[model samples]
Every structure is written in structure tokens, then in C-alpha cells.
Target: MAIIRPARPSDAEELSTVEHAAYANYVDHAGVRPEPMTEDFSPLIGDERVWVAEHEGAVMGLLVLTTRPDHLLLDSIAVSPDAQGMGIGRRLLEFVEEHARAHGLGEVRLYTDEAMTSNIDYYLRRGFVETRRAVDQGRRRVFFTKHLG
Candidate 1:
């Protein structure tokens, strides 16, 4: 079972590990330098909006969402590589949707590198539509948004 709750400062190290492991393959596949994982969670750990997933007492996933006046930005979403295919990501996504609805946000937005086709497809499958694209740091990233009911 997995429980999603507010992140704690104690989760930083493990969260960093999970973040790097999850994105490393994308880095290799894209042949581009991947952004470093959360080097320090001090800035994020304190945010009430950040959440982490724990399964059997282990940190399996984490997501940070920033609420804006008009929208909610999905700042980060990472699941341990080993936990990737088991619905953890979907669970987190659902949680974010609930969060947005509760906060009266109209939409949720996120961006992923163009080379990460699988991620793009996953988001599409989950009801997000590609609304824009951009070249950031020399790499193309597609922005996706999902309207909250």
C-alpha cells in the first residue's frame, strides 16, 4: 500500500535518490545532460503543497505542486524506478487533481523534454493535452495541461 502525504525534511535524501534514478534513463536515452536531482530539499520540504509517497515505510515517490492564482504547476513528479509501472505515478497524479479541485484551480500544467516520448504519451493517456512547446536549455520540452473538473 502507498500513502501520499506532505513531504518532510527527513525525506530529502531518499527523495533525491528516487529523483535521480527515475530520470537517469531519460538522460541516457536523450543523450542530454539531465538536471541534477533535488540537491537540497530545504527549500521544498517546508512547502505544505509538496507530497511524498511511502510504501512499506519506504519513500517510493514524490511530487511538488505550486499553486498559482490561475493554475497549479506540477513542478516535479518522480517515482522510484522500481516502482514506475505499478500505478504509483497515476496515484500521484490523481492526488494532484484532487488537490487542485480543492484549491479551486482550473488547470494543472507540466512540461517534459521532447525526447521523453513515453512521458508525453503517459500524460496524454491521463487526460493532459499538449498546449505548448519550447526549447529550454537547448532541449525541446512540451508543455501539457489538464483541466480540473
Candidate 2:
């Protein structure tokens, strides 16, 4: 099983490396580097919002969440290429919803580059609904929201 916890400053370097590797395969598909790939995790790790997923001492994925007045924002999620098939991504998302509800939030929201087709399908299958589309940071984005009761 993978363990998920708040990120520590020391985990920043490996988190950044894991993020880069996770998004490397999507550059060609997006025609540009995805935002997460270039993010500096060192600073983000200090924010209480960053979470890490690991197995046997090796970081395998990360979740960056931002809290809003009405909902939790799923800023970014990445699972290293080598760890993709083991369900870490799904588990991290599950953690997001659970975290949101525990904090008295009603929903979770996220946006992804529209070119990431598999991501679109995956989110839909996971119970998120498409709320809108827009271009952000020069990339076309599909936004999604999941309402929790």
C-alpha cells in the first residue's frame, strides 16, 4: 500500500524529479510542457497544501491542493511513469475528496490541459463532471468539479 502524507521540505527535490518524469511523456501530446513539470516544489512543499505518496521510502507521486472559500482546488497530481499502474493516482484523488469533506468543504475542482485525453476520461470515470473550458497559461484547459454530500 502507498502512504500519503503532508510533504516535508526534504521531500522537495525528489518530488520535483518525480513530477518531471511523470509529465515527460505528455509534452509531445500537449505541444508544450505541462505546468506541473516546471513547478518548483521546494517552495510548494513549505505550503501546507502539498502531499506526497510513497512506498518503501521512495516517493512515487504527489498532490498539490489549494483551499478556497467554497471548495478544495486540485491544483496538480502526478504519478511517476514507473509507478502509474499501481493506483497511486486514484488513491491521491480519493484522499483529496476525503480531505475536503473532513474540512467541511462541499466540492473539489480541477483543470487539466485539454490535450490530455486520457486524463479527461479518467476524471470523468472517477465521478467528476465537466464544468467548463478555457485557455489558461496559453494552454486550453478543461475544468471539472465533484460535489460531495
What's every prediction's RMSD, in angstroms? 1.4, 0.8
The ten-residue window of minimal lDDT in model 1 covers 33-42
lDDT of 1 by residue, 1-149 (tens): 68999988878888888888988888779997555453456687776756998898998998988899999999889899889788899999999998888899989999988888998999999999999899977879999999987
TM-scores, one per candidate: 0.93, 0.97
Error of 1 at 4 (Å): 0.3
Predicted candidate 1: what Cα RMSD to the true structure?
Answer: 1.4
**lDDT tens string, model 2, 86-149?**
9999999999999999989999999999999999999999999999999887889999999997
Q: Whole-model lDDT for model 1 versus the true structure?
A: 0.86
Which residue segments of model 1 deviate by more than 4 Å?
36-39
Against the unseen true structure, what C-alpha lDDT does each candidate score? 0.86, 0.92
Clashing pairs in 2: none
